[model samples]
Target: MKRRDALKNIGAAIGYSAVIPTAFNLLQSCTSEKEKWTPLFFSVDEAIVIKNLVDLILPKTDKTPGALDVNVPQFIDLYAYNVYVEEKLEEYRLSIDSILKALPIPETGAIDLKYEDYDNLLKKYLKASKEEKQQYISDKNITYEALINLRNQSVWAYKTSKTIGKDVLAYDPIPAVQKGCISVEEATGGKAWSL
Candidate 1:
């Protein structure tokens, strides 16, 4: 056999070895287990607020799972605990605190509040126009920016979760050759690719 044929075979073997373990691991996600989850970073009240916030951002549907269902809050908490520096952690804490001040979280909890209230809040802050967000920055209120960051992070966490990545979106562990000839809608039924 020629050297070229041997090299191609070796590359294919390497690809297969790397993909198998990762694919298997992804198939076994935290969502499958019935473990009790607790917040890793947020305070009790803050955790309640964050939980509500994430739920509003991605509510469950008849067929699709929501952010909370896939553990987006847990992902956010763990990601922050692991990745953030002291100053960033402090900054985000302060940002969330500012938001908390605006909210009327009961002494007992916010369980009684309708879900739409949080959705409205998210729209007012994170979903606002660029100009409005900038105005918030100019006013020295970082809540808008903070909300944007949190929502972006939460959505990323949601998309990367095993359930969403595999079931909701397209999951191709070891990508083959690209087919630019087909439109995106036709390729994966308009579902975004998960990497």
Candidate 2:
């Protein structure tokens, strides 16, 4: 081979050698983080996304437990796996994929993105005006619909949790007095009754 040709080949090899490892590392990190958790209904990536998204929906505050604190994602995973019919399950999977496609990869290049990464997208969809939400329903926007569904379910899971129900919300194991006589604001310090 000519001297110039040999130099060009060496440089090409060097370029690829540098790039390939970076790409591989990025892929491997994502896969490994995802594998750390197994979901009953969703895939590993889906579970991570659900976990982050639900926590954002009901983030931890000084007074109340967050969705993650109550294991909302796990409850959701099991609920879907056990309750959803085959066709509904298929539709749910497809909608989740559509949302996944719309999201940018996390800044960390891993499946377990920072809360902020998911937060921005969620606020855009969930905080829209009623008109815009109705428009999304009319347009049959899968991402918006899926986010709304997840948010509703997350809220349900959060409220129904044993800890939140018994500890955070107003719970009277035995009621000597009637709560209906007073307003919600008076009955439980403005907190709703535990379901």
Candidate 3:
């Protein structure tokens, strides 16, 4: 073959090899269920507790699927693992333990609490005034900070999940021209917009 023809053939071969691996990786990622979530920071028991709590906080209704259904627990775990510093992680761990200790545990080592149990605790925390929350934190030696962190993370995860963000919320993938003065109720029909 001529030198020019040989160079062209070599370039084509290199391009095909590069494209093939990238295409294969994309296909693999799309098809692989083996990417199943495993909590990096939380232990199995702690993860279960987190899951149960988040489920209670955002239970499935006729209108939308709950946190568990949308993998908010996994998202929370991953977010905490990635974002929290050592001190925050320690605080979170203790707070989880405190919450678990407040509930009954079965011989199987899992929490023996219903969704209502978690819901009630969440309600109590949410309803308390700032002073009351601070008092509770002081009395329990467990900071509301951790619970607040968990709640915030759960909300972030739930709102950002594909199930909730794209399917349940008002998602505008191709937004029209920005309207600076529109009411939120008119713009989104009172549904939270996917960020």
The sequence of per-residue lDDT tens digits that candidate 3 reaches over residues 98-171 is 76765566767655656676676677676678898878778764535556767776786677666677888989
Q: Lowest-scoring 10 consecutive residues by lDDT in candidate 3?
A: 23-32
- List runs of model 3 lying over 4 Å from the truth: 1-37, 129-131, 137-143
Worst 10 residues of 1 by lDDT: 18-27
Clashing pairs in 3: none
Estimate the overall C-alpha local distance difference test score of candidate 2.
0.71
| Model 1 per-residue lDDT tens digits across residues 42-119 | 776777778889888788999899888887776676555544557767998888887777676666666565677677
Lowest lDDT block of 10, candidate 2: 23-32
Off by over 4 Å in 2: 1-37, 106-114
Selected candidate, larger TM-score, 1 vs 3: 1
The residue pairs found clashing in candidate 2 are none
Q: Using TM-score, give the best candidate's number.
A: 1
List per-prediction Cα lDDT, in the order shown: 0.71, 0.71, 0.66
Sorted by lDDT (best first), the order is 2, 1, 3
